[model samples]
Target: MDNEFYNAFASPISVTQNALLKNETGTTQKPPKLMDIDDYNGWSERFGNWVEAYHLDAWDHTEVQYFRPLGSDRKPIPIRELSDEEKKKYKNEKLMVSLLQ
Candidate 1:
């Protein structure tokens, strides 16, 4: 894997380790800053490519289901049907960023 990609993937673990070290030293450490969805686009693309390369149709299906959550009644709704603002917010969430990375 690319070093940049590896570093990005390892960042969270590093932060967690730092936090633990600080705690052991009786120091308080602030929480890590979150990344928005735009920050995750590259990672998402990479993951999608990896999945395609592996010939995993399951990953493709999971990706589709991810953007479109099942309704309370278990009905599927297209993610694009969301309002512009909602879409923007979802795209920028940390969960998406982490998963993408």
Candidate 2:
């Protein structure tokens, strides 16, 4: 993905830390944990814009099945009610991981 696009999805702080980690360890780590849904929505919006602007092909990778986030009571959060903060955090994390590779 493009740098500008990645930047839009990630927090400035995370980006800086990612650069530092790259310089120090010669390897990067997982993305910081996200806290809410706004983050995820922002990332998805940026990603959508990138795909539209660049006319990129759709992802064709295998889909991994995972459990939905559950609270301490083990009740899954409703999909429509999920938050975006964690998603943004994860997107940054994925970017950091890509930098390492």
Candidate 3:
């Protein structure tokens, strides 16, 4: 009875200690803000490639029901090439929507 109570209390304390010391099973933790624009662009490019290869079957922009994405006004917009002004909004971004016909 005493051993069970002791273990129940000690288990949580050990977990808290591990988290505080950042020593949870040899896993490395890094802050999210450490990534810059280049890193984001690179990852986005890679992700876009994967999506193109795997998720290309459903890349229609005409039918909003397929993609189900919304614009600022909560309305579906056709996925056309962004103008210079619109491109400015995503200046640092890379590998945006896959170019489709």
Find the candidate with the highest lDDT and give its number. Answer: 1
Tally clashing residue pairs in candidate 1.
1
Ranking by TM-score: 1, 3, 2
What are the per-residue Cα lDDT tens digits for candidate 2 across 1-101?
Answer: 69888877697888887776554333222222323456666544544444334332221111222335787788977655567854543444454334323
State the lDDT at 77 in candidate 3.
Answer: 47
Model 1 quality (TM-score): 0.24
Compared with the true structure, the alpha-carbon lDDT of candidate 1 equals: 0.50
Q: State in Å the error of residue 13, model 3.
A: 28
lDDT of each: 0.50, 0.46, 0.43
lDDT of 3 at 32: 19
| Full-model lDDT, candidate 2 | 0.46
* Tens digit of per-residue lDDT, candidate 1, span 1-101: 69888897578889898766553332222212223456455545655555455434434445554354567788865667777765654554534344333
Please list all clashing residue pairs in model 1, or write none if there are none.
37-92
lDDT of 1 at 93: 51
Residue 58, model 1: Cα distance from true site in angstroms? 1.3
Candidate 1 least-lDDT 10 residues:
25-34
**Each prediction's TM-score versus the true structure:** 0.24, 0.23, 0.24
User: Where in model 1 is the C-alpha error above 4 Å?
Assistant: 1-38, 63-101
